[model samples]
Target: MILHTNDVFKVTRPEDIFETRGRFAYFRVELLSQKGNIDVSLKLTGRLDWTFTRSITLTRKTNDKGVAVFPVGRICESLIQGTKSNLITYVITASEYDHAGPALYAVPGFADREILPEWGDGENISQFYPAAPCIVVYPNAGFEQSLFFPKQTGELFVLTPSSTTTEKYIGNSAFSPIIPFDPAKIPSEDLGKPLAVGATPTDYNAEIRTYYDYCTKGIFLKWTDAAGIPYLYRWTQESKTDEMSVESTYHQLDDTLTPRDVQNKTLAKRYTLHSRIVERDVFNLCRTILGCQDLFMYDPDVGNWVRFMVEDSESEDTGAPMQDLVVEIVRYEYL
Candidate 1:
């Protein structure tokens, strides 16, 4: 559970388990002797079809408190390649003497978002589910279907109205579904409109994500977490105003009324989005939209993801659910 780089040896350490010995209950026997200056080592071995193949071992001498300091999160992070999401499964073995402790199974994902995958009581799937249930995708964007959905054991199928394709997981490392959706299969009129596609292991549901996508139509904004998982949500109230800011001004010109530098003029788009957000989506918007590394709006007119940003704290106005439920996006463009 404790997977932070500096959190090791402080919060999460080996449990001191003791057993009873002798006929007298006063005498207690410990499974492992927790003595200072003792030799201790941690061995981490990957699970079935894991991405990381090499085994990791770290040896340390116990301190005065019989504590062996080992940073599990830091150790696992060193093996990660690139900035992509990595789903890892491994067993942790602690050794003090000749006897090896019980194998502790851990499934941790190091990605853009800080999603802690807890061990469910009857969890059978080897893969981890995204923190959010849905994603806001570009009409023709490509994404691995398995990354968004729980890895289903059966023959997974990705189907459209006009076609069907399949992927599997029993013997495969990961299954990726073709997501550059077909324009022909979709209604010509609805081709670029907002379509919330939901998924199951077998195939995609023929239904939309929310009922509002029908009645309360709006634009969807997208942002990714630290783990690189993207989240898209809809906001109906959209407005834009172009404000020109002059970096430098020169003498008065005939074409311009005021003394202005037309060549140095920059068009800053003051785009505003107003929407009544429900209780659940309020949190998702704050974390994903408010301080996102990159922000985009799905322009219904153009049917594309337009880059924009929430101007600043002042852009937000008081709203029922959250302060910034209504926000104006600002983007600067060279004229």
Candidate 2:
């Protein structure tokens, strides 16, 4: 498989992302020697040679399905991303003593491959009929016997595994099942106003930004000041005093402008005009202008949450117009 650093392979104890949204999902690893039942536990390793150093014991028994469920014992304050570097290590050995054992599995190439392909590829779990339906109520809440997720009360959805479009929604075991986009209606009229379409109880901030390659050093942005002079802001992360811990930082680059560009130029004039260099305040600029930043934030802690982006020229390869700057807003909940 083609390995990519940005690829994510979700890991779980055979549950759904919606079910394990706010927790670390783990699997039940059992050891059985010729002597009958051999005790074994699971461990975790990281990029820095960091290891859990403890064998997490499994207490559940394997049913006729050969599937075993185990309780994590205590709530864990950890978060695992399919696209990150943290690896899950399963160690099987005797649980009675404090000794290391064989490493059952090591996710050395997890970042390059999807741990749960059927689940990750938008395939429905109901089609596969998993070992058992498991959901995570909260992070570090420990593995509980029963859990519940929110479901629409009166929503009608077609479930046909054979037909792709009119097909059934798979993986409905999560707290929130996927809502298929309705294609039976016409496009909503653009009333020349901004509309919000994303997660609610907003947990982010919005800003208009511009980014260009920083030669060969890194990446920087151009933020317009009150005088319309662009100022360079080096992207970085900081702590937010909200719900979780420190949140992801967004690099905001917004500017206010008059409707001068759109007002004077005629329809024909706008089409005929070519390249023009406009001057603003003095700030360092980069060589390659990446694109207009609709919403830009970088948290050394939190990661990117960009749902989509609208290009200026209606083309992915072009830049935005002069009069119009990027507009980006995000909802954030403080820790």
Candidate 3:
């Protein structure tokens, strides 16, 4: 009997050629013999490692169409475990009538990305929400709340909650309570305002306008996705701030300064992300999501946006068995 493989059977998915996990490798063979009931045996052999090799054999009679299809799925998962190398040299051979010598077909499989846990809709690991510009207020003993801010800078009128307030603590450091002021209390009398070097009382208005510009100049951070779409979030010091306190002792004669203690502190920003990946798109995540590291992000404490990388990720199953994949990501980052 004469046998050959079809061109369609040789074509493979790109991921299957690279990463075999979560995919199947298939091949078809056709026999040219006219006789029926001819017994044939198919054999597949491959190296699992330098010290061991594995082989599987299946025997059957060719169909009326003279075609036999082999679906080898997840076999790589078992053979590839605990192996240092991802490269596997394999051969598929067949014999007819139990006396025909083995016909040899050789191929090589290269392992690409490491296999991750199976993705399911219920396995989504992140939950994301659209964030807005606001001050997240956390009192010493009460639930946290948010204060909205306009994009423009202006005199801020602070509001105090009716309940008694205490200092807020981050780590071991304490932050003073936000001072509340009434909008009507803004001083209009310019008695304490500074004057320009050579300006008389009539020119105070111009000097005040120049000073306002200097005080308002500050840098703001901007965050964007891998596609360069900007995030709708902003930060402010009132919501969070970094503080450093140092204490030093000085010697008399040499005027040498000795350090006693120092404390550094800052509050971090966190985000919850919710997303989905269909079965067809799951294999491409390495390139589209995890691979892009230069994306922009917003910081709530700084009142500006800045560039950030995904520092950590966590996932969970979000669907029933054998369903599409969904993931929720709780992302953590630093400025």
Candidate 4:
């Protein structure tokens, strides 16, 4: 098949940061083929591409009558470039096919935007509600939440742009190293058997772990959807301030542990496990509803973390109908 455009073009700035900067870029692709079945792939051919070197592929199959309007989607990673160039070069190639037909050359629209009005007009501000102590996450598509956690209070914005076509997680989503948290406590429901091994335990309080205070306090987590969409749920520690206690359980390091000592270890372990479960459950809930996969938690080692372990529907114990959807947590932070 004869290709329409020699190559595809994309435009972005500081190509390295797509997750926090929340910038938008325009992508243009030209398609040319004899029969329309152009088996083509697009790659970001730029120095900056290494920053977030990701790719998007579009496959068009001609209609029965040989007439097809191929739909192409642009992705942030696809437009990302390692080198600072005015225009990003994309190589589009196809295996030799039949002779070109009518020399059809179709150019897609550009998507780059000068400034995100949503960010400036305060459209996204409301979405960044405060989830004090810890934010509660639920399953809901098209609903997103965001918050800013500053190590030091200042005016600095981190952003990343996402394609409308990118696959987003719904509800009950899970990221890798899936940390399982106890589902929201039902008023009249009994929590089925204890959580599985290595899972976050329920009824955890502070005191036992010094780090819990840091993780739980000054936390600004925004539940959003695929492509960094925002929602309206907020969390506040004030409502339950009295409940924020650093209750501790002692650990009796003994060869022959006493019943009281065993209880203490169980309590300590439960506290730690509970924290993990909360993080995992909240993360998954956000991802499943948001519709973005690749869930990960930020760590010094990986530096850049992706959210994972998403489930879109309600669990068997929910006592509610399941919403078969994908959930994801796009952004989270602790100040």
- What local distance difference test score does each model get? 0.41, 0.24, 0.30, 0.26
User: Where is model 4 more than 4 Å wrong at Cα?
Assistant: 1-38, 44-89, 95-238, 241-253, 257-335
Which regions of candidate 1 fall more than 4 Å away from where they truly are? 2-31, 37-61, 71-85, 89-212, 215-218, 226-229, 243-267, 277-288, 299-307, 313-324, 332-335
In model 4, the number of clashes is: 76
Rank the candidate models, highest TM-score first.
Answer: 1, 3, 4, 2
Over 1-335, each residue of candidate 3 has an lDDT whose tens digit, in order, gives 12334332221222212233322344455555533444445454545555786666765665776556655544543554454333333443334222222212111222223122221122222100011111212122122222111111112223221111322111110110111222122133322332111111121111111111112212222233232112221112222223333334343433356444433333344343322233322222222333232444434477454654443543343543322322212233322
**Candidate 4 versus the native: TM-score?**
0.25
lDDT of 2 by residue, 1-335 (tens): 11111111111242222122113234544333223233334453222234433333444444443334443313111323332322233332233533332222121111111223132212232321211121111112111111111122222231222223323221122112222222111122311212111122131111102122222221123322221112232322221122233334444444654332221221110111111222111011211122333323323234432222212322122343332122222234332
Q: All predictions: root-mean-square deviation over Cα?
A: 11.8, 23.4, 25.5, 19.6
Report the candidate with higher lDDT, 2 versus 3: 3
Which lDDT value does model 1 have at 22? Answer: 11
lDDT of 1 by residue, 90-128 (tens): 332334233233323222232332222332211222222
Better of 3 and 4 by lDDT: 3
Which is the leading candidate under TM-score? 1
Query: What is the lDDT, from 0 to 100, of the residue 300 in candidate 3?
Result: 45
Better of 2 and 4 by lDDT: 4
Candidates in descending lDDT order: 1, 3, 4, 2
